[model samples]
Target: MAAELMRETWSGEVSVVTIGAAKSEGGTRSAMVKIGGQKTLPFLFAEGAIPHKPVIALEIWDIAPLDWPEESTKPYGQSIKDPLAWAQMCVKEFKAQLLCVRLQGAHPDFGNKSAQQEAEFIKALLKKVDVPLIIKGCGDDEKDNQVLAVCAEAAKGERCLIGSAVQDNYKTLVAAVLADGHNIIAESPIDINIAKQLNILISDMGLPLERIVIDPTIGALGYGLEYAYSIMERARLAALSGDKTVASPFICFIGQEAWRAKEAKVGSADQGIMWEVVTACALIQAGGDILVMRHPKAVEKVNKYIEELFIPR
Candidate 1:
């Protein structure tokens, strides 16, 4: 006798969120990126539908990175000196579907760029690149609150994904994104409960759950990758099993985490790129919707891998 295949059914779906607005949508972006709207686990086409393929975003900074080692810096050459040039290089050369711009210069220890400066910088970046953007603030809580607010207003109606409202310091950024008609990134410190709670906190501020993306604070290949993967997998399971509070797409910072691994540093240039590529693939398997990465080679390879996994479903 022949046996029948058994599959688990999901009761809830991941909410769909659209990034960037085009000329038709009252914004300048020439294209938009849509993530989420999954009814099953990652790539289980036989079980359910995966409406969107995971997108890889190249990471650029408002200021040229001072600490990146030679292996990573050699790719962009002098374009890294200017954020506009760097972004254009990523879009035109690498074909990045999205860009993650870090306002690192706004940190007090960095350059201490004023709120207005950051705002203008964002406005200029929007003009230079036509792809959707994910605007991240410098990791200073008080400073981020001030800087992201102004930057959010500067890009109002563009529908960028402005982020990173944490448990203790989320009110300002939440209000900023809500007021500007953009989405917010809810960040938690690698804790599932904290991740869920932060999403609730952000949504309670009058922003709908669909407009929030969860950043579950990921780690690199050798550094707590399993732990972070477990957290993400658990969250995905909960979302599939009818949990709406945590049913949001995930955005993982692959470049920032992968390059920091000692193994990536203690090896050849190819090893470093492979480290990033492997980390990115693993996360996508575990259910990552938006991956913010560096290294053009790594991005090139991962784009191929995504094509392989996404079987036109």
Candidate 2:
């Protein structure tokens, strides 16, 4: 007799959040990316529906990244000096499906750009790229509160995914995102409980649970990746088990974490690329919906890897 096959079923689905709006939706994006709405674990199609594939977002800064190693900067060349050109290169040359604009220049230590300046930058970027966007703020809470709110309003109706609402400072961004018709990213310090709490807090402010993405603050390989993966795995399992508050899609900042590792900077360019590729691949399997990455070569390899994973068995 043939052995019986066992398939696990879940009682809940991850919230499906769509980024960007096309002409039909009253925005200028040529295409929109939809994430989440999974009924099972990542890539277990036989078990349940996996609706949308994980998306890869290339990171571009408002100002030139001063600390990036040569391997990371060589991809864009002169485009790095101009955020608009950098975004264009990612889309045109790298074929990036999504773009993440990091307003690092608005940070106090970076350039202290006013909220108005950041808002203008977001406006210019929208005119330059037609793909969905993920706008992230610099780490300064005070400055982020000022800048992200303005940027959120500036990109109104565009349906961008703007982050990040942390436990300590979420209300401003949450309110802005809610008012602007954009999704919000809830970030936690790699703690599952905190992640859940922040999500609930953001939702409490009138933003639907479906419009929120979770950022568990993952670490790169060799830098506590195992612990980060464990947290994400647990979160996914909880969501599958019917935990609504934690059922949001996960967005892992893969490049930001991957490039910071000492190994990526100390080795050959190939080594750095591999570090990013491996980090991204691991997180996606752990149920990451959006991966914000750097380095076109790394993104290229990871895109091929995603294609291979999605191939029917």
Candidate 3:
């Protein structure tokens, strides 16, 4: 008799969430992307169904990014000064499937810009790109609530994903997302229990589980990347074992964390780009459903890797 293939069966699956609404759906986006709905680990086709392939979202800033290394900003050229132009370049020039607007300028310590300023900037970006948008706040909890609240209203009905709602400061952001008909990103430190707890808290506030994406916090290749990887692996395993609280899709800020490491920022051309590529590829294999990246070259390389992994043989 011929040897037979053995596969482990899973009882749970990731929830499917759709971002962006078309004109008929009450928003102006021309396209939308669906993530999650995986019945197995990332790209484990032989074991279970991978209903949707992972997606790559390019990060654009409302204000010009002054701290980015040259290797990461070279592709944008002159468009870096203008948010609209920069976002358009990402979609039209780099072939980005989704765009994430990081409202770094709203931080009091950064630009001290008011919430309305960031909201208007986001409004302009929505008109410039038809792809889905993810609105992220600066790391400051207080400022994030202020800026993201207005942003949620500005992008109302567009079904954008807004967040980074942490354990302590999720209420305001969660309420804004719920009121605007947008989705929320539940962020937790690299702890599986905390990750699940945050999701539960958001769900308790009445946001559907499907509308939430878990950001378990990322660590760059040499900077505790293994810890991040292990956390994600455990989360996915629990989800597959019928744990609904941790079953939401995972999003990793690959570029942000990767470039934060010295190896990716202060190295020669080869080292700088290679670090980001390796970091992103590792996260993908570790089961990241949505990756927010900065460098276009890194994005392109990761896109190619995803194509190879997702295509049917």
* Total colliding residue pairs, candidate 1: 0
Model 2, residue 11: distance off in Å is 1.0
Candidates arranged by TM-score, highest first: 2, 1, 3
Give me the runs in candidate 3 sitting further than 4 Å from their true place: 1-3
Candidates' RMSD to native: 1.0, 0.8, 1.1
TM-score of each: 0.98, 0.98, 0.97
Give Cα-based local distance difference scores for all models. 0.92, 0.93, 0.91
The CA lDDT at 131 in model 2 is 95
Candidate 1 C-alpha error for residue 147, in Å: 0.5
Which pairs of residues clash in candidate 3, taking residues 3 or more apart in a chain or in different chains? none
**Model 2, TM vs. native:** 0.98
Question: What clash count does candidate 2 reach?
Answer: 0
Clashing pairs in 2: none
Q: What is the per-residue lDDT of model 3 for residues 81-107, given as tens digits with 9 covering 90 to 100?
A: 888999999999999889988998988
TM-score of 1: 0.98
**Model 2 alpha-carbon drift over 4 Å, by segment:** none
* Model 3 worst lDDT run, 10 consecutive residues: 264-273
- The residue-level lDDT of candidate 3 at 256 comes to 86
